[model samples]
Target: MTIPPCTESGSSVLDELKAALGSRVSTDGELLQNRAHDRSHHDWAPPLAVVEAASTADVSAALRICHEHHTPVVPRGSGTGLEGGANTTADSICLDVSAMNRVLTVAADDLYATVEAGVMKSALNAALPEHHLQFAAGPGVDATVGGMAATSASGTTAVHYGTMKENVLALTVVLADGSVITTGSTTKKTSAGYDLTHLFVGSEGTLGVITEATLTLHPIPASTKMGVWSCPSLQHAVELVVKALRSSLRLTRVELLDRVTVDALARYTGYTAPVTETLMVEFVGDRTEVESQYARFAGLAAQFEAAEHASTSDPAESSRLWQARHDALPAALALVPGSAPLPTDVCVPISRLPACILATQKDIAASGLVAPIVGHVGDGNFHVAILLPPGDERAREQAEELNARLVERALAAGGTCTGEHGVGLGKVSAMAMEHATALQTMRTIKASLDPRGILNPGKVLAAS
Candidate 1:
């Protein structure tokens, strides 16, 4: 929805925001245009202004200014989201919180850390090495902690450590009317009242603007082991993942890459593995325990006809292997020059993973679309990145159709349309289709929290 420019009112609102924030406010055309969109393929609609919030107070003051003018405010982090969660329309205030990046407190003794909203995940982990503590939830992108919490992000390590929803203990949020409130507590367990912390965790900025977060941290692994196994087929690789997941191996991550993806990785990066279905597995614990886990994993792989077990315990070697997984998307994109990647993910029961992936592969082949498959198969989550050639509307249409069918297959298997990526503009229809009557309840919650709907309008719920 393109909101017409409120030239008169927008000028007043910008003036007011500048008055409140001085040099922090910006009405620069290029800056507003750039802040209006994220990594998604969504069309950009530039906001009226951009506010670089340096503190929680700045966020509150900015929100208050927009609230008084009945203007919409779209909160943004690093703009790394693949979905259109951070995209904005005209006449809206683009609140960039990246300036607020700061680690507030690190309670190593208590296994938690509090940070201002804009702290990047990699920076937090880097800061924790001296304390022998690390934030376990790892997304592929170096996203802001606030954005990770807002999207409830999970990645490779989530198969062991869990998602942002589990790691986050509390949050400092600035409500629509500039009211500040803290949700959750420092304690690990809390049943004191409504789980407001969770309500905003995946709210995608519809409920409030997250300013700070208290997150759970875990001790650095004493011993780390990683390996890559070659499988004859996708079915065998998935079977091996299920077998490993069912076992007591203390698995840290189990990722899968199809033959095409492997080829792409080999082409983009010098890291070459067997150009077949492969599983990258990791285990962390005491040296003896990690070795035992790898031995057991090797035995299971052998049963599934998986060969070429390349194992590593050295930190440098382990990092090199994992970097391949993190660089999967870019490598796949490199395979098809001048193509826009449409990445979508879904999660299903472990038992349904094989069938879901196989069927999706068949659908991709039938549509003749270029998509490479990769997944965190340990937890029944995977992504099908569709590479649509430039100016090929028909190919884009086919990819869209394939995506819908994949979602349907996942839904039929009792899974979500998205596992880690929240219901941004891309999945709003899927959310409604998946939730049915329950969606009304979510709308009620959104309405209650943001009455005027000035907070990130047209996202999560819809344009209505």
Candidate 2:
């Protein structure tokens, strides 16, 4: 866990960085330890130093110095990533960009906003209410926009609004050599050459550092109705979701919570619903349109033997309802006090969702693990939070085995190893199984962009 010193002449790279960036560079032991890991289960050795970059110039200067010394650089935002995409290695420098937060422009007429990478999603939405627009990409966490773009994050809204890949219009990225380039433009569509914007979207900082981004925005819906329905079984709930997706219903969000998750929510979040498979759905449109869609969705739910139905148009009630859904993880953790959570997600084609989820539930039952299943099922993505008792190696092994089996099942069903969570340190092993030859092409692109192999080394692809 010792950081190898990179020296220049008589002085070390750390000395040079300190001289160049002044107080912006810090070797504080506590800060280095704090910045070494993210919310992921994996932890790495403490970084050599942390560079708090307040502006694009600072990012360029830091990258320039790190590139020169061949020191690995890990770009970080708010450090809320569930994967270790922002985690730093022992010999690396953690480039903290959360200080660059700024909303540069709100083109309400054009339905887009230009923002610095460090701006949080909550802050952006707070500024957009008066404009009657909002950034539709919701990762359910107040994550930095740059981190969201790096992970191609998606959440409950992605079923209708699409993920970050579709919402990000342009990017200002600092290359490994400190050169900055802007990819894409404000134009909605372009038949331009290779789409470099998206190429870097999910690169996870292994290619370059994202300093700023232009994000596509959507008008606030005139009417939004939130509803929850308890179904007889998981199969019934998933069937209802599939039916709703195919029907004329304009669902803005569709989420599923299995019986176990519903029980946890009921106990922890005061969720008043039957302990059965449930669906939390949202409809957005004109009042009349939303009403019609709600009626249609209710009929579909009834066909699947859904019960204890609840609907709300009041903003406060709606927020409370979705808040319960977002608090699923914490509620699940309460199921096993003092247990750590190992969360994993996978996305499959909609048609195969029912079987996939049912199979996972069966696996959880057989594994004797207290894992709760919840998901954005409209697009066929679901998550399992496996709770492990503290320092229980047996439970950890069982959780890992369960995750491996679940991933293999998803891959066999034409799904990905990860849905919104990027292949940070957790899912790197699955990349070969999922992408095969395409992974090699990714390595080629990584080499082309970062020849020194210093950009967020040992992530996305294993360090060669």
The candidate that wins on lDDT is 1
lDDT of each: 0.90, 0.89
By TM-score, how accurate is candidate 2? Answer: 0.97
Score residue 299 of candidate 1 by CA lDDT.
Answer: 91
Residue 452 error, candidate 2, Å: 0.8
Candidate 2 residues 383-413, lDDT tens each? Answer: 9999998899999999999999999999999
lDDT of 1 at 333: 91
Off by over 4 Å in 1: 1-6
lDDT of 1 by residue, 77-185 (tens): 9999888999988878999999888999999999999999999998898999999999989587899999999999999989899999889999999999999999999
Work out the TM-score per prediction: 0.97, 0.97
Give residue 29's lDDT in candidate 1 (0 to 100): 72
